[model samples]
Target: MSKLFTSYDLSGVMLSNRVVMAPMTRTRTPSNTANELTALYYAQRASAGLLITEGLPISEEGRGYLYTPGLYTDEHTHAWKEVTDAVHAKGGKIFAQLWHVGRMSHVSIQPGNQSPVSSGEVPATNTTVYAWTEDGKEGPVLPSVPRALRTDEVQRVTQDFVSSARRAIEAGFDGVELMAANAFVFDQFLSSSLNTRDDQYGGSIANRQRFMLETIDALAEAIGGERVGVRISPFGRLYDLQAFDGEEETWASVASALNERTLAYVHLNYQPTITAAEVPAGFGAAFRKAYRGTLIGAGGFTRELAEAELEKGDLDLFAFGTSYISNPDLVERMKNGWPLAEPDRSTFYGVIGAKGYTDYPVFDAGNESLKTVA
Candidate 1:
């Protein structure tokens, strides 16, 4: 039988198991800080070897989604420290995901309802942002035309990532993952279709990859490369996905560009996008040689499939998103091959605390009232 409960060492930090809690946006935090109840929420899921937080804004202007956490302020740092302290009490490791929306966010989230600042004020082609409505879960309104960022401003954004990462470490997080994936600000610069700049930050693939790689380097300098991870969705089709399929040329270029830095790990978010025909192939065996660190394959993988992929020696870690959402004891389930409880679709994003969050029960191993069988 396969040992799903095997412990793995990631840059001197040993995970209790292969399971890692993928970041899911929960808009329940009031004042944009993780509270005591939020501590309980993460502590309850401490059974997983590691946990990565929902997207955390790097600056006030970087906040795209409402109610998501931020690490820019001192108050926010202390609040996150409380949550991390709780996880430490249970011997679990957690990392915060640094994020920015670029053009995918509205001005409401920004300072003056101005379009989100980006590499170029280029409006995202076919993307809408999800803002918190009074009713909850409704508005994905068309955002304002973002103002293009000046060369100096682009450099500032990259530096901002480093500052936010330092704050995350101060807040007691073990590490931080750069939110380079998805249709956020990093994506804005990465996607050739979105960035039409004539400057150093645009034009060819090398120019497009400049901002992302620089940001990663900045974060690595702030926090050691061993403690820094980069998440990228090679063929992500979010927010005006015209360059969705670079075919082999695009993805290979992406991997080659990221070749300089010794990343802690590179996460490939494979999802069925509108751009390509093949289900977005994550960094499988092909990238094992390209990247010189742990390779994590996420976005739509089942336990059986994960095990099959892991056996190939290409994938070092796996991130379970939705499956881990409903089953807080997912590691144990994989360990015993136990049946999983189906998640309630209605309650997946539910507002109620402990309802769909922590109500799931664990296995009954043996009777406590055992006879003297010595």
Candidate 2:
């Protein structure tokens, strides 16, 4: 049997296989609440050993898009229970990815049309946010220049992450993953170029890493350390994030810190930006050596590439993004050597109905037409 089909223990949770359904934003929830469609969508892909849901805002201020879900309200928690229940019914395990977009947001999405908050008063360049017009039509809008967060406010934001993690547990998630990558709030603090503050949360790599480490400690305190995972993109320059000196050392220090915590896993996204090149060769091996925990790699990984990494012991699990958008039974398809389906890029996001959501066909040996159980 292929190692991909074998089970692995994540902390105390037993994953059925090594294939992970990487979180991809599909903008199907218009009300920012998981509904029947959301439940069915996740249930369809329950075959994956681990399913990381799309990035969910931790609070109203954290929202950067029009229709993404949240975890702060009772409605949000209850709605997510439906999704978790559906996935659990099919014997699947899942983790909620908590997010805060920080400076990457427009006033249109901010509460009371206020400016977004960030580590400093920097405006993200070469990027646009999903904003809404006066008539409630969604369109791309330039993000506003954000105000620097005060020292006290930074502490509050850390607490917000802790509260959101608690809510995720209440919502029935087996675990929770922090969205510290892709130039979001956490990355803003970690970046020397973006974080120009003179406070303790800024300067030297140790000071710059304070916020993330504190946030991780708080999350581990609220939820068990074994149930917390973090995602990072060390060399990421996405959303106009500028690279500074000591880029490699900064990440190495971050990984060493995580190693001390003994968390469930560290998810590394190799695709820093939509247009960025692949990660430098051997970066994963170096990261694995730094962090002696389960390491999951995400990018445009093929079955062959994933198998190679697992065989070499570099990656304990591999996540699929675009493939999971169309192939609901992605793990089974990869395991059985079935021909995979091409995803419809046009309907990948901002779709209100199920045309491209839960309507994708699973592989059928007897026929070629797409078949959907939902």
Off by over 4 Å in 1: 1-3, 125-127, 132-138, 244-247, 271-283, 350-352, 363-374
| Top-lDDT candidate index | 2
CA lDDT of each candidate?
0.76, 0.89
Q: How many clashing pairs in candidate 1?
A: 3
For residues 276-318, write the lDDT of model 1, one tens digit per residue: 3354355455666676577777777778877887888777778
Give the best candidate by TM-score.
2
Give all candidate RMSDs, comma-separated: 4.3, 1.5
Evaluate candidate 2 by giving its C-alpha RMSD to the native, one decimal.
1.5
Model 2, residue 153: C-alpha shift (Å): 0.8
Residues forming the 10-long window of minimal summed lDDT in candidate 2: 270-279
